[model samples]
Target chain A: MTFQVILVLFALFAITRTSRQYRKRKVSLYWFLLWTGLWALVIGIALYPTTADAIARFVGVERGADLALYLAVVLLAYLVFRLFVRQEETERSITQVVRQIAVQHPSKPDETH
Target chain B: MKTIALIPAYNEESRIAASVRDARSFVDGVVVVDDCSVDRTGEVARAAGAIVLRHVINRGQGAALQTATEYALDALNADALVHFDADGQMVAREIPMMLEPILSGEADVVLGSRFLGRATNMPFTRRMANRLARLFTLAISGIALTDTHNGFRALSRKAARELTVTLDRMAHASQILDLVKVRRLRYVERPVTITYSEETLAKSPSSFRAFGIVKDILKDKFFTRI
Candidate 1:
């Protein structure tokens, strides 16, 4: 019972933070909705363990906790891949800008040389 | 033809001057892209009669070469461009040999081949690495050449203008070969001597870094679009 209460409280806190970010315009409406839905699902599973078990059985998973772990792992891996691609893109942009600056102001050799 | 030698240097203050001086003799002008070296690479190159272009931050050799290529084609209006290493390893005397194919309109690009000529003081490990890189290049780009990553190359203005180096580091060498094959640019290899010193060997990328290059190239081939 205490563990269930803790999970619910954590989910509520995350939902609150997500809503705050949405209000501050830091997150788009699409992201806000996705996060809110995710937290609500978490709250529902925490409040009703039977619902998770039912869904897990339907998905051919033995345990609800195991299903959650698998989902989390896949999502984290996808997010990491996205971050790596984004970092490469950012680095390419920086190189392009630096190249332009170097090209514009060339330092010619002195006349004496 | 109006030829310009493009040298991409990073903290090569001691060797940049000699390389620039030697390259200036063969080409009409020498343009050195200083890759934000903490040392006085730019000053030394400039004093050696090279047009110095300074990068605000250190990008990499590939990025520096791309910047120099743009400057050579656009600003200098060069008819041909020679890619020379800032390190004293490459013999600037061979610039003409590299440029012959390009000048005669026989090939769009000319690559230097140490295997065909001489690799003075080259270590056994370096030779093995070069062979492996050649095979890798063949597998990836479907182009077979004696040397895959020689820094000494000559490109016609059209070749230089068409080929773009997107990889910003050691991988750029492989990327250049890939572009040559993809763009269907006529390329030939010329015998050139590379005298490797302890300093040059020390500065070269480690064997482990080859894995990184492979990974970068694979990612570029499959994940990213040029």
Candidate 2:
């Protein structure tokens, strides 16, 4: 019962945070949908643990908890890789913009003329 | 042809003024790209009669050089472009030697080779590192240049406008050689002297710089999309 309550609270928190980000235009609808689906699936599994065991057995996993842990680790690694690639792209764009600004306004003493 | 010297500077306020003054005597105009220097490099360069362009953020030497090249071609309308360092290591006397081929229409690009000429006070480790860099560049780009990292160079306006330097670091030197190969630009190697000062050596450490260059080249070759 405590586990189900904790999962319910987490689902609410995640939904609230994602909606805020969506309203701020920080995340797209596709990402919003994806996060919602993940949280919903987690809440469903937490409420009905036996259903997860059946699905886990179908996927050749001995335990539902192990399956959840594995999927969580894989998702976290993929998200980290995406973040790294995005950061590199942002840095490259910043360099390009900085170069253009530097060239456009030369700090010459005779620029007043 | 109206020639302009482009100096890519990063925090060499002590040496930039002298470099600008020395280069001013030979070239028609000297343009220095202050690469977000913490010191008063832009003011010193401008006071020494050099057109100064200040980067908003600290991009590396390659970005600074690219900015100066574009300004020389687009704003200054320079017929010929010369790339010189602001560390006060290169000599002004050799400018004419690098420029002669470009002026006589013999080559579109002129690269200075320290091995072909003279190097005073150049450290032994730097010499060995340069030899390794030569082999590395030849193996990657298939062009065996004696001094692959020399900053003193002369480029015609067409060549300067044609070649693109996207890397914001030391790897752009190898990228320039890649451009030379891909564009089929008429290039000649000229003998020019490089005197390494204690300050210049401190700013540019050979072993650390070699590792960074190799990493950047691999990233550009394998990781970068274009």
Clashes by residue pair, model 2: none
Per-residue alpha-carbon lDDT of candidate 2 for residues B72-180, written as tens digits (9 for 90 to 100) = 9999999999999898889987888899999999999999999999888778888888889999999998887899999889999999988888878888899999899
Best by TM-score: 1
Q: Give lDDT: candidate 2, residue B128.
A: 88
Q: TM-score for each prediction?
A: 0.97, 0.85
Q: Clashing pairs in model 1?
A: none
Native contact fraction, candidates in order: 0.86, 0.80
lDDT of 2 at A33: 94
**Using DockQ as the measure, which candidate wins?**
1
Model 2: how far residue B28 lies from native, Å: 1.2
